[model samples]
Target: MPAPQFDPAAPLQFVVNAAAGSNAAASKREIIESVLQAQGRRGELAFCTPADLARVARVSAQKALSTRTAVVAVGGDGTLNTVAQAAHAAGCAMGVVPQGTFNYFARTHGIPADPAQAVRLLLHSVPAPVQVAGINDRLFLVNASLGLYPDLLEDREAYKARFGRSRWVAFVAACTTLLRAQRQWRLRIETGGTVRDVHTLTLFVGNNRLQLQQLGAEPEDTIAGTPGDGSMAALVLRPIGTLSMIGLMLHGAMGRLGEAAGVERFEFDHLVVRPTLPQGRRGVKVAFDGEVTTMRAPLDFRVLAKPLYLLGPQRSTATAEAVSRAEDAGA
Candidate 1:
């Protein structure tokens, strides 16, 4: 497929998620409007709650598709995922305004963290192809996990509710979850036509290179050489004692998980994971991006053949600098 051309004069449709981080402020609307006016761009803003983001995004995307404009997601990765689904379906370009806790997708694409800067960048940026992966038919931009990881996410949400949201609080919650987790999954994994049975604490499938680097699983060369290869990297943590698990957590925190023992990493175009026991049928909890859901046994994961067109700075400058800094900082 040919790359979509970006037009500076094109109209933009902004889909805002009010519950997103930094978006709940009353002044945000004024800031966005001011920026659009300053840029002399035609833009329409629509607000929606988290629950209605997907439907609103689809409506906005359809309008953009008909108008030959771009649809911008003004929230986090989950919001971006929702909007991207519509944009991809309509063959329209997508942009971001990064108002979330992690904003991993936006940061990786070299979109600035500041709302004003992100808006300006998107206004002048071009459409670039980005790879996205899927578990069953649901798409995810970052990574997806099963087992202890999903449980940790649930615990993290509870912690956030009780104590409020902050990086330190999230870290503490993760540590607590790690210390208390006692379960493991005995699973059968099929990839590349080979089946293997193993006991693991968690399984992670990653599509974002920066995330893989942060986890210390993929080397710089591998990532640089195949930035959009339409494949996902798998990191499997074999069952281990609590002490060893703590040690592994420490390694991961320090961005050195690749050197951690009992870690297995591989790349595949498609794979299937199922419980080794016949009686383990009740469906498994899988966490994608920041959302959790239950999928029946024998989960199917694969790379999407088509790429999503995202509006951001070209890889040669912005992305290269961000990646270089992350590498230098050992992140």
Candidate 2:
């Protein structure tokens, strides 16, 4: 991948999600200030509360776009998504500090999980063009899904609020959702001139190769080989019995989802999915990245030809080594 242009003299604008765990810490602001002061760099930090994140992100993005400043998101995927929407709108380079439950986007881009390290890396990194996927104009850096997956996200959120956010909690929530809502939707999918009807419990469209590998939807060998290809991997889970669904869940938990029966995977530049029944025309629930939203019928999914410039390590041997180390640390 080609490196995005960067100016060392430009100011950095950090949009911190105060709701994020790292930002909730009282010393986070001091840490950021101290780091930049030590580096002799100037930065403006904007704290975004849960109630006004959208507004704060938009204003920050507008400032970045106007001033040609780098806007860094200091939170998880949801925070990144909000800032990304603004950055994309303003046509400015975006950066991220992984401070969320699952920092898939940051991990995929080789960003360190440690907040101080992440900020230091951002200071030295340049903009890199990365592929961005969309479900009806909403941009997502990782993946988007429909049907039972969205329901699972909803259930997971509720469970998270009650039991706390953890891998085990998420797993339990997934089980609860699967057992409680076994309803399947019949969708008519069209991609690359092929039109087919399918009854699926969930459909996932993945843009991040690392996430695809984790889900076992793509072969490990092909994960790093395909980047900025302007294509996405789609995994469709067909309707199955309760026992079989449980088995599928086990396979997914084991990182063998691709080996599970009734799971279909495809790579496409564009796809159109619609419900076979008139009742489905109302709207379809979609989970983009980790945020849930309702999208109208005939959901159009595609990759933007123009990439989003993100502040991250330039793809190189050293970067690869760093990413490997980060992955090992995360594991």
Candidate 3:
């Protein structure tokens, strides 16, 4: 939509996931090579299994920095997140080609799933600033959560493995896991110069507006859209009975979660959460951008000041103006 800000002469480096099928990934690589060759450009491809994902990302990121090229991720949101962490640290422009169960990040940023079409768009794209949030030292592109939420992700993964990877399976697994909720964590949460101690089932943070809206969280009303604006939405679910939990799920399904009872939704520039963990437990389970991991107590979540340069569709001037208007109104 805007004038291209890309270097036509520079090569494109892609980090592809071969876990699903080496032959499939290889076919995509061939397509990418053909596209680039037709344009008289060069492109590099690094195929890696799940175990080799991180190492390949780091190497591709370093190559991106040295060569001043874009590091493209050719997989799902989790793979994109891993490559993004490397590209963000190296301060290189990044691109995406979605290939996951849910391509939340790519879809939010308007990146296509078709490899050739996505690469064609990349050639005409610019390195624009995109907002990124951090939990402790790790960056997350879509959403992050702890407590019952991470357990739900784990359960959903198990369901996906046994049944199949589909929206129905994920939704059923999530509803099942959510209905069985019996655990609650006592937490000290600090935000907006205020602190409170409360028991919550989960503390979920949202960065992408689409997912938040789907969950009936209109955080965009208060959270600024401009990059490095340091605004995010958080949802705190307190301990509730089974009936209330079922109603909460229905509200979320109906896109009215923000109005659901026993759920506290608010916007903040930064948040600090201290969870009470058992003795000798090194870290608490946390899930971000569809992947689960463990982090130590006192998980710090915040809007990162430094923006990640993303190569994709341009943000409309009207959208940018609306963000400014919203920020000013809040001020």
Candidate 4:
């Protein structure tokens, strides 16, 4: 891992999120005190409710504008996003202490979920400028989602809390929605200086590609993995009929999308999605990092390069080479 770029002697502000992954977020008082005592670093710890995150982040950023203080987010991706935005706005570096569901960024970056280790990293690790995205006026550290996935996130915690896993319930919900929901939007995607029109079930614009590949007669799915790179992927799923949807599920059981013709992948720095006809006039749901919001037809998605400082380990050289290849292709 790269060394922390900040001075070790600087004052640190630890922001703890108490409602991150579950019904309520966990408290970090014990861990915070322990880490502070262990490190002997003079720092102030602040517990933030969900309502206080934005305010605290903004305030921290403003203070950081003049003072050499580092702000740490002690929560999940959303919380980290808030902190990143504020820290970036304040022109200060931020660190993560992941304590939430689907700690995608943390997992990828090697930030430990353990509070003590996270604190150690925050104090010792170097902070580097990382990439972030902006949806309209809002900023996001990870990729954004548009379509069914965003809607699913509304109930993601509820369903996952009840089931302990997401796939089965998500698949069922998606199937049920597909059966009843009408898929009638036309999207004109412009990528790599080429324009293509497609009618699709859902559109995913992600900062990285996640791979969930397994060898079997069953379906193999992957998650996008590259969120920090200065690019995004567009996964367009073609609209299918009821029978086709059933076949798709069967293929998923076999570990692949049975009909793969319409699954087109596009990479671009900017995207403009325009509705085609009258039925397509119905707006789509767009989420900036899983928070759902309504967007009119012709949604525009763009990438903001190196929006904030992230402290994480570099992927292996081979992985870096492969990523370079992928970026070259996408470019």
Candidate 5:
């Protein structure tokens, strides 16, 4: 796809997610205005509450494609996911303005936190196509993890209400749950004509094909590749003893574990996962961009290559290229 065009003379429309970032609306508005001033551009802002993000995103994306207006997602990953997906479906271009606690996607792609810097990048940067992950019909911008982590998203609203947006607080809550969580999953994974029977603790599917910070890498060396490679990666983590699981968690926390033998990782265009045990019949808890849903026993996932027009600094291209090469070489 071609790069997204920006006309400084034209107004940039922002669909802001007000409920994000600790429910601090005033600070977000100030940041937006300051960024516009810094970019020397004047634009219109549309504030959206959490309840409105999905509908507003569709409207904004349609308007952007129809009128060729610049639409930006100004919130955390979830907000970005909603807007970007709409833009992709509508065949329009989009940019992201990170304002949430963990803007991991933005940071990985070199999107600035300061609205002005991000706007400047968006105005001048080339639009690079980025891939997305989808399970059945649901799409995910970042990786989706099933099991204990997803269960956290199942209670996100309550957790956010009680703990606010602090990652530490969320982590504590998750750990508390994990202590009693059972990993009695019997999974059948099919990829590249091979079907493997595995009992795992978690299943994480990443569209960008990159190993996340805390999450382990795909056992098949899939994450080292290009983001828009038109392929998806999977990391199937078998359930170790709880004590060993804790040790692995610490290793991942301290940044020590990557591509260990115990973990199985693979890359594919499509796959199916089914449970072998009756207790697993209710299906697993699946998470899509922080939203949780209970899925049937069998799950299907695929990669949508070059689905979004991402704006970033000039260095992103080089970094992405390097990563792609590394993935190809199984680095």
Candidate 6:
């Protein structure tokens, strides 16, 4: 089926993550409103706390479908992922206005980081199919992980709360978390009808090729071109000492993680992982697109059967190379 066409007269539903940034929500609101008013386009802004993100996104997405409009996600990858879940489930078109650190999803999809620019672009753009992956029932656009990676995200949030949000602080937080890492996950991984057990510090899945590239976790031709042209990638980090872990961080910082020792990379369409947990524990901490949450064991990770339609500006070859036809009519 083809994507819904862009209807300028229809009201665009914008779900704002109130807890994403330190800046005043009013300032962000003004920026969005100014662009909409200047273009004479109808837009509805719904500001909700992080605690209310899931609920608000669901409501906004249903409203968008009812009104025959696109629901816009305005924040970081976590916000985008949350909104994407609702939009994908409803088969509604979605737009993005990036406002978080890294902005990997937006940048990869060619959505401008500047709120006004992104909104303006979406106002005149049509929707195209974009590949999205899932971990259990939750959607993750950038990446997803378990064990040490999730722990790192929790620590990163704490560091951000105290030192403010920035790439540097996130790095420091990751280092802090790595120095104390000791737990190792023993997982039974099943893929392609083959099962294997392994011990790893973290099992990370990648959907956005840009991120995989940055981390040097390239997966040949399977990592690019969404919808029918690409597959998801996975990375496994073997347990290592603190000093070795520090070296691993340096490799990642320098964009050579794939070449780092004790690191394994592979591509797959679907995977099932069963982790051995402590006695009496039935759930495990998992992080998807920067947000950490507890999920029941026996995680199912796979490329979703249906792609989410994204409305945005056509990007240059550089940014959209990961998904070369992401903005095309046939995408």
Candidate that would win on lDDT: 6
Model 3, C-alpha of 56: deviation from truth (Å) = 0.8
lDDT of 1 by residue, 208-280 (tens): 7777777778733432234235577888888887888889889988888889988988877788988754464
Query: lDDT score, residue 252, model 4?
Result: 52
Assess each prediction's global lDDT (C-alpha) against the native.
0.81, 0.80, 0.82, 0.63, 0.68, 0.84
Error of 5 at 318 (Å): 7.2
Query: What lDDT tens digits, residue by residue, belong to model 6 across residues 1-331?
Result: 6676556689999999985454768888889999988998779989889889999999999989888889999888788989999999888899999888877677677777678888998888878787888899888888889989999999999999999999899989998898889899999999878899999999998888777766776765543443222688888999998778888989988878988888988878889999999899999999999889999989999888788889866555326543443333113
Name the better of 2 and 5 by lDDT.
2
Ranking by lDDT: 6, 3, 1, 2, 5, 4
- State, as a TM-score between 0 and 1, how close model 5 is to the true structure: 0.82
TM-score of each: 0.91, 0.90, 0.89, 0.76, 0.82, 0.91
Q: Provide the lowest-lDDT 10-residue window in model 3.
A: 321-330
Q: How close is candidate 3 to the true structure, as a TM-score?
A: 0.89
Query: What shift in Å separates residue 202 of candidate 2 from its native position after superposition?
Result: 0.8
How well does candidate 1 score on lDDT at residue 163? 97
Tell me the number of clashing residue pairs for each predicted model. 0, 1, 0, 28, 6, 0
TM-score: model 1 vs. ground truth: 0.91
Q: How accurate is candidate 5 locally (lDDT)?
A: 0.68
RMSD of 2: 3.1
C-alpha lDDT (0 to 100) for residue 190 of candidate 4: 71
